[model samples]
Target: MQEWWRSAVIYQVYPRSYQDSDGDGIGDLAGITSRLDHIAALGVDCIWLSPIFASPQADMGYDVSDYLAVDPIFGNLAAFDTLITEAHARGLKVITDQVLSHTSDKHEWFQQSRKDRDNDKADWYVWADPLPDGSPPTNWHSHFGGPAWEFDPGRGQYYLHHFLASQPDLNYHNPDVVDAILETCKFWLDRGLDGFRLDTVNYFFHDHELRSNPPAQTRPQVMATDLYGMQKNIYNKTRPENLGFLERLRTLTNQYKDIMMVGEVGEMGNRSIEIMGEYTAGEHRLHMAYSFAMLGPDFNAEHFRNCIEGFQRGAPDGHPYWSFSNHDVPRQVSRWAEHSVSEDAMARLSCAMLMSFEGTIGIYQGEELGQTETEMEFEELTDPPAIRYWPNVKGRDGCRTPMVWEKDQPNAGFSTGKPWLPVKAPQAAKAVDQQTDDGIMAFYKEMIAYRKNSPVLSRGKTTFIDQPEPILAFTRKADAEAMTFVFNLSKDTQEIPMQAEAEIAKGNFAQIKDGTLTLEGNGYVYLSHTGKAPI
Candidate 1:
């Protein structure tokens, strides 16, 4: 069998917002199974479910209470089995989020580990003794807010929590902890799971010596938190020991047929790209990995080029996963609004740009409709980070709102009852049922189909074409076929000289009539050109 995931188009499904079948306002497993047809119709290769494991709903299922049990609110184990069966029946691979870096504070392992020093699970989590004055072991800060350590009075020590205090970092330093996590993973594989989307994969291990991280060489302007951004984060995560564990995880996956895993390198800025390279450098680590480099608000051609080229140089042996939006970040349409002509045009451009990138691509649900982030209020917020840092940090709740299916239906046909996240006028207007042939939905379908059919798009090596700002150009060549792709990144029309004997393979707002190409705002063109790489 071929390595399907190497070039597959993945669709991400946020369980809480996709659909609700029980009329309880919350989405469940049955809801996902019922919606399989909608997903299959999109021509995607796989469906990536974001964290459905049993949890206390803290950090929205990123903190696992039980790896073996499916949360009752979502459904039982039987429902999950049916989801896998139905998804497979439609020729779609099913993968799930494996939050291995941490577990819910309520997890049996963490509970027992916190109870006493001599318990069997005492060393399962990263626990450190308080400093002389009774403070945290080191000066690490949590991603959410406050200190990364929580004082457990009973254990007389502090435990490391990279994210929320409820989500304690697992002690990969312990061989037994690694063994147990692997067993948990094996259970799913035995159940016929296609793969996993590893959450915070780099945070699996921490500094054994408990050293303080040095200050960041330059405080980046994009930092949301106060102290977390100031430090370079050398000690608390992305430890070298994590590489050995990934090899172990990869070996376990290799035992199964056609199984693939994509890890999310949790670091930001350039370092994230570096981590992705190390994590997927060879056959021994992750099959592929993604970094937040592309997820941020960098909209220019140089930023995009630097990220892809950086990864190529850093991990020539590794594969990359590309995406513009996900559950954690603000929707792309809204984040990059200033640079686009319209939401629909922005959606189309992002989709086309992502398709041209030289890596496996992922498209989040609702992106087809050009769904913008929901405008939330303080009272309506349920996200931990949003609630903690109001105004300053708008948080991620805006992007987790319910999917819109029917324009006129209550809760946009996502549920019969009031939805967990509201469907406001902005998103409801872009409902799936209301879209026409000329709408964003149809544009996305066309682009996805084209990418799938063209070998140049799926298996091409990209060479960057130098151009002025607002004009992003590149060429993808594979075997005997070569194609030129150019995207207009701003709201103003841009013109650039072109050289190639070609016909328009596909595109909009672009035409080569006089040895020069003109691209309108948010426009793109794909050319089936002859000769060497287009410049």
Candidate 2:
């Protein structure tokens, strides 16, 4: 099998927000097909699209109703075939989101599973009887809110749902369920998909004993998105059985050439590294896995060091994928709002840091133009979680707003009608057309092209330099050429002490001539060693 995914830069496209060719206030496959030129021009290796499967849009396509069919909201199967063909013609691989951990309540399997206990698919979903007191079998909490178990009146039993009740968790312990999911995946693989971005990869299995999760030993006061994180969530998710399933998934995909799978592990802090390590430890499992380590609000030198170094220690032989932004989280620029760098500078610095690392990188759409989170009012919200937990949480709708294409155009060229989520003025200001001349968009194109052309940036081994707070320094060396990357995470200027012989190679910093390399607040510089490179 060709390992083309490694050293490749992937661009994530949220289908519902990428572009609306029909002016239906939602993006479709045709819209994505029309925009392939823009993605190819950006020089991305592959495009990872969010769910386009038939869905009720309960979780914005995360709750898939049909695995083998395309939703009319996005387009028909013909549109998908055209998209894959067009992307391949542009020399770009295509990947789609695969939500195999669970399916929508409307899915046929789940529907039959909830009909009665003696049904052929009774054991398809995780169903259990209530306790003596008529309470849920376990004290598990849903990601959205309330209990993870929902009672079905027809079956007189409670079924587990890690997310909203509209999504019911599949029983991986059931061999038949595994066979069905594998078949569903084969359906897509037969259609020539390059790979799949597995959603909630760690949540594929649960403890079969239905044990209650122990409470988290420590609890810091947090009001962010309810009390979902208050517990350890050991039994609720991240079970050992998930690894077995992942191995099987890998076995299925490995049958095809150049096919890869990247799992999204949502574990936080140090545990995230452990999960990533275990998932991608060998060739028989996931090709690559990513954690929330780089997607959070922590931007300090220690946080950055801890994340990368932790991954290095945990996954010594494993390949990891690093990303800064996605459809679920707020834009990195706004999340790290304390850093006072301009949007243009920050975008370049972010791309440099990600591409400089020793692994595959994922870039969210509109990030090339330095887009920020949309400032949305509560009234315009369509996200269920945001509406449910209003005032305290801003929900994900702000980050998942329609992509802005043309500046000074209606809806910023996202839609002819009102967008699903209102686009903010600040974000629209950085639209694609406005920055085409000489700004962040152009810089992004140049940087990506450079990453593709340069051997050190594209495929090299990384070495970290132990520096103080707010300053991150690393080196990527391939063959005889070694490039040192230094970053300033703070809003204040910081000086990186380097030898007099170090020569600046390619970066956006201003002070590179002096031995004391100066980075003006969130600035970064790349240097090529004129002397012997640091071992």
Choose the strongest candidate by lDDT: 1
lDDT at 158 for candidate 1?
93
Residue 193 in candidate 1 has what lDDT?
97
Tens digits of per-residue lDDT for model 1, 227-288: 78888888999889999999999999999999999999888878999999989997899999
Best by TM-score: 1
Worst 10 residues of 1 by lDDT: 217-226
> lDDT values of the candidates?
0.91, 0.87
> Which residue segments of model 2 deviate by more than 4 Å?
530-535
